[model samples]
Target chain A: MAVDKKFVGKTWPTMVYEVGKEKVKEFAKAIKSNNPYYLNDEFASQSKYKTIVAPPTFAVVFGAKLIEPIFMDKELNLNVAMLVHGEQEFEFYTMVKAGDILYSNTRIIGIEHKEKLDVVAIEIMTKNQYNQDVSKGIYTFVVRK
Target chain B: MKAMYEKNSIDAGDTFNAQQKIDKYRAIYYAGASGDFNPIHIDAEFGKMVGLGGAILQGLCTLGFTADAVTTWIGDPGRLKKIKCRFSLPVKIGDTITIEGLVTEVHEDTGTVVIKVINQNGGDVLTNVQAEVVTK
Candidate 1:
């Protein structure tokens, strides 16, 4: 069944994630990066952020909090078995640093039904403890019908 | 951001490239880090059963690779103002991704970079790749 278009603009509750230094290193290494900004704290301390930072795509880590509930949302009733990531976009306003308290919110921005697949786009907006916009990600998923 | 940009001289027509070999266990590592343990990415048998031929790397991980390439060149992770891409093809474990970037345009504070990411097979794994970086 296609996800109901009525669910467009639907939103979930905010999620809070405390960026961890080790987790950031794990994510950076997973992506095969040894960038001093992410892995070398002494190097990062002298840089603009003044602390170890995460790669911009780290938005997905915190953003995943929003995705899980959406995938399990009874009303959405998405066919998780058939779904795949189709597209992604991220706009970074501030770099995420270790120890930052991130507050993230998610909303359904789009839904389209075709003959054989359904496309859903969700927007996740995140802010740091200072309420500075850290990043905004548009995650698009395609489900084969 | 300004202090970081002071060290690099970015101009239009500048180009750079980077590559990452998607080792067999790369996806598993990514799954642990990103919490995207969808079966098709971790189980080759399940992937084949699903008609994917084999377990595939997460699209976000591929994007992460590209982001790494761009940021490494720009010299500051924080200056990457925006990036967007369409996942045109599945990147399998053991596939090496080659990222090439061209600085097509530049202004006083930001530059527009067009990125092309291809796999070892010469397939366009990521299309419509573009990123914006702040210079000052």
Candidate 2:
């Protein structure tokens, strides 16, 4: 099945994700990162951030949540099993903290079909509940046929 | 925010080292967080059947560790703008992966930095990451 090119510009519904301290620590531990900046508030406060900070890739989990609707759409002809994370990129406008309430909106930026692969790109823009843009990510997935 | 970059800057080919003994508990925790419970990453028997001698860690988990490396080196947590990478190989349980990164490029206008990571044993290029961070 071919993916709909018309869906390239389609935008998914917004998702609200609450950043938590435990989640940050879990992600840090999972990666075996002993960075005090991510684990200890006291150490973090000593730094310029003045608070605990999240790892760069912490956005991957939340980014996925914001774009869940697109992958869940059957009409996209996307097979979850055959999908592989091809590449991901994030652009940060501001720093994110544990207590921040993040609101994210995702849009499909590009789609291309080759003989045996479907390349799809999704862009997620995340902002704090205060409506300040924090980061924007462009994720590309390769769906094997 | 105070500027930390003024005091330290990581150059390309600069190495960062750390270790992890992939224990059973950590494996389970990763499975829960990543929602990736592939048998090879959890069940040793299943891992052997797939040609791996024992359970292996998820690629994302390794990538997460790489992200931690960046945060530690930069001395800031929330300032990471981007982290992008491609998984080139698999990491098995009990294997202590030493994550290392080099500053490949820096965009002065954008304050973006590019960093690349390689597993210590040279087993796999775990992550090829580019980030736009706020530097001093």
Which number leads on DockQ?
Answer: 1
Off by over 4 Å in 2: A45-48, B1-21, B24-27, B34-56, B105-116, B119-121, B132-135
Native contacts recovered, each model: 0.86, 0.63
Residue lDDT tens for model 1, A42-140: 788988788999989999999887899999999899999888788999999988999999999999999999999999999999999999999999999
lDDT of 1 by residue, B26-123 (tens): 99999999998889999999999989999999999999999989888877787789999999999998898899999899998888999999999899
| Candidate 2 TM-score to native | 0.80
Q: Under CAPRI classification, how is model 1 graded?
A: medium
Cα lDDT, model 2, residue B23: 64
Fraction of native contacts, model 2: 0.63
Per-model TM against the reference = 0.95, 0.80
Off by over 4 Å in 1: B1-7
